[model samples]
Structures are given as C-alpha cells and as structure tokens.
Target: MSYFPAFLKLDNKKILIVGGGYIAYEKLEHLLDFSSNISIIALELSDNMKRVIEEKSLNFEKRGYQKGDIKDFAIVIVAVDDIPLQARIFAESKEYNCLCNSVDSVDYCDFIFPSYIKKGDLTIAVSTSGASPAVAKHLRKYLQELIPSSIGEFLQEMKELRKTLPKGKERMKMLDKKAHDYINTWSSK
Candidate 1:
C-alpha cells in the first residue's frame, strides 16, 4: 500500500526505540536531527551506540524490551533483527495509540522514514511509498547538491520579513510571491 507523506512535529514528544544495533543507531541518528527526546531499550548496545547515548545524554535501558513498554511514547521504532519482536512491538504500540515503524518491515510499519534534506528551517523530503528507498536517497542527495547554501539565509530573511508584515491575505500573497521569485531565480542559476 502507498503510504501518506507527512512531517511530524516531535519537539517535545517522546520517542521509544527498541534496539541498539546498527539499524537502531541509524534511526537514532535520523531522529537526532529532529528530536532529542528519545529513549532506547536494548539487551545490548554496540560500542558506537553506547558512545552516542553517553555523548548525547539520552535515556537508555540496557535490557530486553518488555510487553508493556509502549506506554507514553508518541512514536515507537523497532529495529531489531528479530521479526517476532518487531511484530509484537508494532502490535503493542497500536494498543497504546502510538505510531510504530518497523524498519525493513513495511507490513509492521505505520509509517516509513523519507530521505530528506534539512537546512535551517527548510526541510525537503522524498519518498517512494516504501517501494524504492534507494531512489529516494539518490533524489535527496541530488537535492542536497541542487539547493543553494544561501537558501537558509534567504529563509531567515523571509521569516523576519513575515513577522514585520501585518497578517492578512495581502501579506500572504506577498510572501508567496517573494518565495516563488527567490526559488525561480535560484533554480535558473
């Protein structure tokens, strides 16, 4: 099935990760880009994983995941090689009304991570509805090269200008036009 594309605001929300191996570390790296409010449960952590958790001062429990560990988390990511555990966590997460993502297992995922580019306040995401992650990664890399380094500064300028302007349809239109023009000029270069 085709998945919906969305960018969640996870600033203050809690995220639970049930693994501490390579895949878990990769997911943690991605999550760090957005939110630092993350908790990891694992029987054993890789050396790099332990180092990262210590460096970031992230919450971690060095134990196997329990049955009712899905409480209070806004999102849960299962990255273990154990398919049964992944399915179990995904099911448990559903009962708690939490979104779950089982990496490499689309059937057990409520959502999939999109390859993305983040520059200041700018975020661009690419996905193939879980069909081709490689394509998405390539497209993201292409965009990373295509997007000008000045785009972040430009966005900051736009943000400041927006605050100075009155809130109205005219202001919205002006901002829209300004952004479009800026992008058009950038793309032509």
Candidate 2:
C-alpha cells in the first residue's frame, strides 16, 4: 500500500515518544527539527539519551509506559524493540485519536517518517512508503547535494517580495519568472 505524504503543522502539537533507546533517539532528533513539544517515557534511558534530554530539558519519565500515557498527545512514536508494546500503544492511539508510528512495524503505523532535507524554510521529503527507507535516505542525500547553498537567501528574498508586491497577475508572473531564473542558474554551478 502507498502512503500519502503530507506536511503537518506541528505548532502546539504535543508528541509522545515511548522509548529512550537508539531508535527513539533518532526519532527525537528528527522531531526536534520541527517541534520541541515532545515528552518521552522509558523504563530506563540510555546515557546518551539522558544527556540530550537534560540539555534540552524535555519532559520525561523513567518508568514503564502506563495505559493512559498517550491521552493528551497529538502523535505517538513507539520506538521500543518490543513489538507487543508497539502494537498496544498503536491500538491505544486510535482510542485517543492520535497518530501513531511504530518503528519497523508498518501494520501499526498511521504515518511513517520520510527521509527529508530541511534548509531554512525549505523542506523536501522523500518517501518509499513502507518499502525501503535506506533508498529514500540515499535519494534525499543526493537531492540535498544538488540544492544550492544560496537557496535559503533566495527564498527569503521571494518572501519579502511577496509581502511587498501588490496582488495582481503581473506580480505573480514576475515572481514565477524570478523563481525559474534562480533555478536555472543552479545547473551552471
């Protein structure tokens, strides 16, 4: 089955992560790129995880996940190695109307994390549904290398122009041409 790729506005969204191991840490890193309203629960945290949590001062608990831990969350990420635990949390997520992502378990996922590149205001995502994340990651890396370093500045200039320009077909045409011309210059590099 194919999954749809969508960009969710995570502002004010509360996220719950149900582990503190390596996989959980990876998910945490990715989520950090967009939102900081995350809380983690684990029976025990790895030393590295502990350091990151302390540095960021994120809300966390050193205990087994409780039955109701997912109640107030907008999204739940089950990164524990235990399949049963992941399944249980995924089931619980439905009852709470929260999106759930069970690592390595496609059947229990409402969403899968895509390999992505975030440069300033630009975010490009590459996904292979549930098939192969490694391929997606490699593709994202290749795409990232091709994007020019001046892209962020160019995008910012476009933003200012959009705000200052009057609303009309002419303004739109000019902006479109400008964007096209900017992209055309990339091939020369």
Candidate 3:
C-alpha cells in the first residue's frame, strides 16, 4: 500500500523502542537527534548501547518488553529479531491507539522510516514503499551530494523571513519565490 510521507516533529514527544540489539541501536542513533524523551526496554543491551544510555541519561528498563509497555508512548518501534514478538507488539499497540513500526516488517508497521538526508533544518527523505532499501539509501546519498551545505543557512534565513511576513497568500507567494530564487542561485554555484 502507498502511504503519504510526512515529517513528524518529535521534540518533546515520548517514543518507545523495544529492543537493544544492533537494529535498535541504529534506530536510536537517528532518533537521538530529534527526541530526548525516549525509553528503551530490552533484556540485554550491547556494551556500546549501554554506554550511550548511560552517557545520555536516557530512560531504560532492563527487562523484556511487556504487552502494555507501549501504552504511554506516542510512537513505538519494535526492533527485536523475533517475528512473533514484533507481531504481538504491533497488535497490542493498536489497543492504545499509538503509532507502531516493526523493523523490516511493513505489514506490521503504522509508518515506515525512510532513508533520509539531513542538513541542519533541511531534510530530504526517500523510500521505495519497502520494496528496496538499497535503492532508497542510494537516492538519499544522491540527494546528499545535490543539496549544498549552505542550504541549511538559507533555510534559517527563510524561517526568519516567514516570521516577519504577513499571514496570507501574499506571504506564501513571497516565501515560495524567495526559496525558488535561492535554490536557483545555489544550483548555479
């Protein structure tokens, strides 16, 4: 099924990750930049993972994931290798009306995490509807090379301009024009 792509504002949002293996660590690495309010539950974590939790002072429960452990979080990510456990978590998450994503299991996911390129405030995401992650990664790399480092600074400038501009179609037109002009100039450089 095709799904609409959206960028979620994760600042201050509670996110739960149920696993502590390499997959879970990889997800945590990305999530750390967006949200500080994260909770991790797993029976055993790798030394590196434990160090990260300790250094960051992140909330961690050294136990296996429970059925209702996901009830309080806005987003839940299940990265365990066990398919049955992932499925169970996906099913149970529906009871709490929370968003769930089981790694590599699109059938059990409420949302798929796309391969993305991030530069300061600018972000570009690429996905192939879970058909081919390698293609998504390649596209992300291509975009990374295309988007200039100055784009982040340009985005900041646009944000400041947006605040000063009046709220109406005129403001949107000006913003779009400014952004278009900036990108055109950037591409020429």
Best by lDDT: 2
State the lDDT of candidate 3 residue by residue for 1-189, as single tens digits: 777899999876799999998889988888886777989999999887898899899999999987789888989999998999989999998899889999998889999988988888887889998989899999899888878888888889988888988799999998999888878985786
How close to the true structure is residue 46 of candidate 2, measured as C-alpha lDDT? Answer: 81
TM-score of each: 0.94, 0.97, 0.92
Candidate 2: Cα lDDT at 144 = 99
lDDT of 1 by residue, 34-119 (tens): 99999999999988889999999999998999998888899999999899998899888889999999999998999998999999
Q: What's the ranking of the predictions by lDDT, best on top?
A: 2, 1, 3
Q: lDDT tens string, model 2, 91-185?
A: 99999999999999998999999999998899999999968899999999999999988889999999999999999999999999999999998
Error of 2 at 19 (Å): 0.4
Name the best candidate (by TM-score): 2
Least accurate stretch of 10 residues (summed lDDT) in model 2? 43-52
- How would the candidate models be sorted by TM-score, starting from the highest? 2, 1, 3
Superior candidate under lDDT, 2 versus 3: 2
Report lDDT (CA) for all predictions. 0.92, 0.94, 0.89
Candidate 1 colliding pairs: none
Ten contiguous residues with the weakest lDDT in model 3: 180-189
